[model samples]
Target: MTRHPTEHPQFYLTAPAACPYLEGKQERKVFTHLIGKHAPTLNDVLTHGGFRRSQNIAYRPACEDCRACVSVRVCVAEFKWTKSLKRQWKLGQDILGARLPTSPSSEQYDLFKSYLATRHENGGMTDMSVLDYAMMIEDTHVDTMVLEYRSKGPDSFITGIGQGPLLGVALTDQLCDGLSMVYSFYDPDFDGIGLGTYMILDHIVRAQKLGLPYVYLGYWVDGSPKMTYKVRFKPQEHLGPDGWAKVD
Candidate 1:
């Protein structure tokens, strides 16, 4: 049976740009648009092949003379919480992630802006306006969700919603095999809770509850300090020339 044109994604290479993860290095990417009824299927396949989703686009590094970007996914069923991980988890026990729609809001944008200002002032996303942030959350064709992390309220047990100021946000994608953490941000002032690491632990538990075996954590650049946290989620698999293989 011949596949439809949309099912056979056409990829395009990006123009070289300064690498975000490495100094004095350039980066290029090969990307394909995800659309139509087959978008979810294409997302799953491309993700397993080391591609990452950004809106309707699925892309992977196509840089010349570079192989630092490695796709990582936590093995949900095999994950064992470390003492530090457990401490991080307990720190956020008063909060929970509430699944919301793809719609963006002023509150969420406020938190996003603050996070960018504090944690990534000199980074690429620092100039994103509120509209740009909205597009990032709303411009999607595949399965996606906005997980709002907030303080648990009195009626949380019944309504399953949280109250108080938003502490963090996770833009996640539910794929055929697992939840892909497309993006996440938190209030930098609210330190000591380890919100970033706590969010990943939540995703791992969520994946297990849903019977998903993996939690895609996107690319883990070998030498990038920003990516070092990814490897701590042990019992993970890294995509390679051969295929997915366990990496410690």
Candidate 2:
């Protein structure tokens, strides 16, 4: 059934489960479905309010006693390329990323499997089958796209597409004010090349070119080494009680 764009959506909370970022603690989330004609607008609003999209649901951490997860977004207009970031950018100069419609391909699934095996073997998504991966990419109502990165080929300048094996992929959403990075993974063999950071930097540039002012980086949890990288982007804003405030 279709709902009005201004209609208040019902929110549900998930039961507490083992916290992925913090060991020995539990985490819960408040989520709502993104569907119908208003899904895109609703996604924009929820994203600005600190929620992140996964599949057709928008959610945020609602842990009882922990507030470690802070939503962050890069202030793209004010972002400066540091020397280190410049080096990383040069390292990935041969790679070209293209934004494609939210569709699944066997090649993407193969890369996803390899990424999970090498980087997150013991994580929750390690056992995901091809069907599950397809659903993750296709079961979306908002303006979602997959940014596929590959080595620039001979025809890249003409066709705007690379012609080699996929090196990285980012599931992203385009909102009214920014580009939200839902999830991203890269080839583990290219770990030292910093493909993950390269993707974020690329997104910031993409956002700036589109006249967008932000690039949402999802939740950056304190004390989580894995999540620490999210803070590397300077002049970022963190969602707080007073809404998005500059993080120094």
Candidate 3:
């Protein structure tokens, strides 16, 4: 279907692919290009409707039998940290995180390579090169940002870029309603730091400060240990066939 320039973004279906979260299921996506003059506005609407952005593509699960992929957003206003989350913050207390424009850097690529090698060696994105990484961060047509986490320097204002190695990174999209976590990675060497959990905590705070009510945590697939972490943030909402419903 041809969509007018003034119309909302139009979507298309993807061919079946192996489900990344589930063991023996196939997955498909309903996607659209979020570009042109209406990208920012289109992005907001799509996100509210449970779509996720990767570069300029906005997609959501379109599986035939499984509805396991649930879009979740933390209600920043009502989010209360668990004792462990507080301790996770303390564990990563020394790491300084700064949000900057979505521009790619070699340091990011290096760390990304290391992370993929160690954690996702057999994953689909394992072979992505620096140019691919660059595109992932910089090719966006809508509002996006990169949050870099590292060890802080002595000078606050003139602090040097985090040196030695990259600790963590968050690829986030700034929507009209909230911050969508497009992707994130951390130095696997710092496994004990719980940087993944800490980053989510930080984003919740950031969302509240921005006066945004939600922080999109992407999909939470039931029975997937990798996705179970997303449910820890309380007072979150999940998108269902009926609509966004409050989850425990």
lDDT string, candidate 2, 136-164, tens digits: 99999888889999999999999888878
Residue-level lDDT tens digits of model 3 in 1-248: 87666366567999999998788999999999988878888889889999999888989999999999999999999998889888998887677778888889998998998888987887889989888999999988888889999876666347635544579899999888889999999988886678889999989888999999999999999988879889899999999889999987
Residues 1-248 of candidate 1 have per-residue lDDT tens digits of 87776677798999999999999999999999988888888898898999999888899999899999999999999998899999999988989899999999999999999999998889999989989999999998899999999889999988888899999999999998999999999989996798999999999999999999999999999999989999999899999999999987
Model 2: lDDT equals 0.91
RMSD of every prediction? 1.5, 1.6, 2.2
- The global C-alpha lDDT for each of the candidates, from Candidate 1 onward, is 0.93, 0.91, 0.88
Task: Please name the candidate that would achieve the greatest lDDT relative to the true structure.
Answer: 1
What ordering of candidates by lDDT runs from best to worst? 1, 2, 3
The worst-scoring run of ten residues by lDDT in candidate 2 lies at 2-11
TM-score of 2: 0.96
Residue 90 displacement (Å), model 1: 1.3
The local lDDT score (0 to 100) that residue 134 gets in candidate 2 is 91
- For candidate 1, the TM-score is 0.97
Taking all chains together, each candidate's TM-score versus the true structure is 0.97, 0.96, 0.94
Q: Which 10-residue window of candidate 1 scores lowest in summed lDDT?
A: 1-10
TM-score-better candidate, 1 vs 2: 1
lDDT of 1 at 8: 73
